[model samples]
Target: MATSAPLLGKAAHSKASIFYGADEYLEELKKRYAHDHEIAALKNALPGEGDPNAAGVAQSNDKMLSVQKNNENRSLKTNRLFPTPNKPDPMPQNLAFLFTKITPEQMIYMWNVLTAIFCSQVLMVIGYCAALATFPDYWWTCTLCFGVPFSYIAIQNIYIDHDVMHGATFPVYEWQRFLTHPFADFFSLPWEEFVLEHNRHHASTVDLLIQGEFGWDPEEFHYALQQWAGPWSSNWYKYLLTVPFIPVIHFFGLNDTGSLFALEWWMHFPDEGAGGKCNKEFWSKWIPRRIKHNAFVLSLWACIWLLGTYPLGRPLSEGWRFMFTVSFFARIGYSAAWMFITNFTHSF
Candidate 1:
């Protein structure tokens, strides 16, 4: 039920560290922690802010009730913003004052999260193996119960890759891609391609809001699923395509437009010939990158299968099922969820 604008910079930090052991996270302790009592008390016995909640002036339940209703009551929901814009500042604040703050706990968090991500990857394979070996004919029950949620690691990787791409994770931005790649490449697009694609989306922010005079968007695909638009395929045909490998389709370059395939060959490669012709030289430069990415993705799948078979002591087939769960099944679930959200949103 958060309502106020997020606190930025050091205003967001908790000055206190863990009192006993190392703090597991950031955030100031709450003041009047969990005071609601009536099936709940009719009155507050809890202290106000800046004190231990032993005893304080008791008030009616109005404050708690009002606060929990904050979003519904706020005037910010109107068609016109209720509050006027801020007056221009004669003395502009220093940008450094709002630069993100980091603490010792926050510094080690990347290693902690990366460990969790990779370790969970191993656990995911183990879970699949356990399901296959233990239950035999009923193995799919375990995958349905556990593998579905676990496969969301693909989504998690994209989120981490997003932060890394934005250079917000660490000051060593160039090296951050090392954390993103091959891992985030699970989605099949190289980190560079994702960066370029996402940057263009951001660059098109105004265009997304304002359409051309013709009443259509300037660009057909604002939300990255451009392939689904228009007379591309029948609905059931798209589902059939999705069933085998569409989740990882971007990896195979089937998701790429002809123009996208002919785009720049990245920074270090030889330039495409003048006017962006799709001649042999251009294809030669782009094909190498395509090969590298395809290898990475295939190798990742093989590692999962091998690890599942040898170490986890399950049939090698279980690894393949795990891949399908995370890719095809996971993609379907997420796409369905995302469709519900964007279907009603102008922000898309």
Candidate 2:
């Protein structure tokens, strides 16, 4: 199973080229890939241990694990060359035209505007939902109020961040870390891990077998897909309960082991469950970063509490329960929106 490194050309990058010699090869590959998922047996699949344990990490490019432990060359970057538009086709006069990059100033200005809109939309949802919670009669109304606008704006932000991750907005990848601070964090999607897993989807959208760090083998990559598929394929309660409680998991004695793969570039692991003492010394000293993330999120919630108690006018007696309720509403909208998209948006 030792495969050579990919060549330096489109043929090497083309996933179809891997099976180009034979007809019906992709169809057969699909069946094999599907069979691997079937055999992996989601019923018994462990959620967080998508990669091997630290002691048994995989470094070779041949074995595809969801969280590929390419610890061998963690410092080196592995990026595909994207074609620069020589003279792009004129975009029809629409809001999408803003996404096109003509100059650095234009790119930053547009992304900043988008960042403002995304933050404001989220804040509005939170403020409205928290305000309406004071009215017991409008409990269900709060659901729709948050769901509609939050889902609409979040999906748009997905496209915006998608471009950001592709290095369209920031020339430096690490600087993209700030993109998560309040917006992506509020949504519970870690910017680093999402960008890594997401770009792989585009790199090999047809077969999803990208070489290098992601470890594209389906046999090992199934759990990552299962995780991304979210509640549609993974345990529903795990997503609903465990996901939001990540910042609190370390407070209790419980923690799920996370992906052992460590890289300077890729920095977040919301789903990988990186917290607590059991894995205190694991992941090449990188897992502890999750603690900082949790702390930062908690700090933001503290900000939310001040916002809720004073500006939103919640009683001091309400404590964090009111803030948690509003946060729950926000997450439920995100969960519902994502599940709906994954389950119904495409025909597989």
Candidate 3:
């Protein structure tokens, strides 16, 4: 009986320990549940209606939510801040694609050709000036000497400008940007306008009737003919006279003058109302800049002519005459050649 009493006492102690541990665990779980309940109540409370302690808890939770939202927003902003780099366009497989292939040998050949052409122009100009200076009486010979070479150079540059427009050159040679682009602009169509017009032509493969330099639209042509040949003139005579002059007019930049009026109309009368007139601000700013650019280019040429002639005892009047006469004849030659080649069998 004594031994049995000791065993029972030990079992009782073990059972009490187990019960104590279970009570501790239950107390911990109850605390956790109470904490969660308080949080829920705080969230559910109306603004300014909860207990002071509950309000404080709600405010803290509100701040936490706000911070979390801001973190998410910041994450979103960071993701969008910098864009991925774009891949370059792939080369097209077409006739125009041939221009894209530029081997080192080809580049060297082009460089050599450009150098020879530029040198020839310089030599021709020098010879022309020398002839004018030495034999002022033989003006016709001087004219031919200057006009032929100058025209050749002009037309060659025009072709180069065309290539540049088509991205066949210049764009490949980053180092030649200044010479091929801005400097060239002074002698040909403005680079910006040229690219715009050329791109329009390329994009109009199916829609060829769109108005442009080479397009078949006759609105501007008819207007020009009426102004030049008189409104009542025979259509056949007008066509004969005006058709030949189209290329010359284009080369001389006269074709663009009509756009000034159109621009003025568009700026002020965009909505098509009769009360709208030309915008003074446009005239004051845009027109003057264009005029200045053209005048500056012309003045540079005039200076060259004057300086070249002055050295040879040629009068300024004779120099001016020489300059204009050569320019006129060269333009005529260019126009005739271009028209003959491009419109040989085509009706338009």
* Candidate 3 overall lDDT versus native: 0.40
Query: Each candidate's lDDT (Cα)?
Result: 0.38, 0.38, 0.40
Question: For residues 1-348, what per-residue lDDT tens digits would candidate 1 score against the true structure?
Answer: 111213111222333632211132211111112321110111122111212221243432332111111233322222222122243455356644443343424333443454456566656666666666677687668767665665466456555545443432221222233334343324344444444333333222223332211111212232334334234445546534433333343332222211122132233223234466443443644465456655765676677657546454557676665455544544443333323322223233
Predicted model with the maximum lDDT: 3
How do all models score by TM-score?
Answer: 0.46, 0.43, 0.46
Worst ten in a row by lDDT for model 3: 60-69
- Which residue segments of model 2 deviate by more than 4 Å? 1-106, 129-147, 167-176, 179-190, 208-214, 217-294, 310-317, 336-347
Given candidate 1, what's the lDDT at residue 321?
53
lDDT of 2 by residue, 176-275 (tens): 3444423323323234344434433332232223323333421222233334434555476555643344333211211111112222123322223334
Across residues 223-322, which tens digit of lDDT does each residue of candidate 3 receive?
3542455433455676676666666544553322223322432332212223555444346543553465455546645755675557667677667654
Question: What's the TM for model 3?
Answer: 0.46
Flag clash pairs in model 1. 37-40, 37-41, 38-41
Q: List the candidate numbers ranked by lDDT, top first.
A: 3, 2, 1
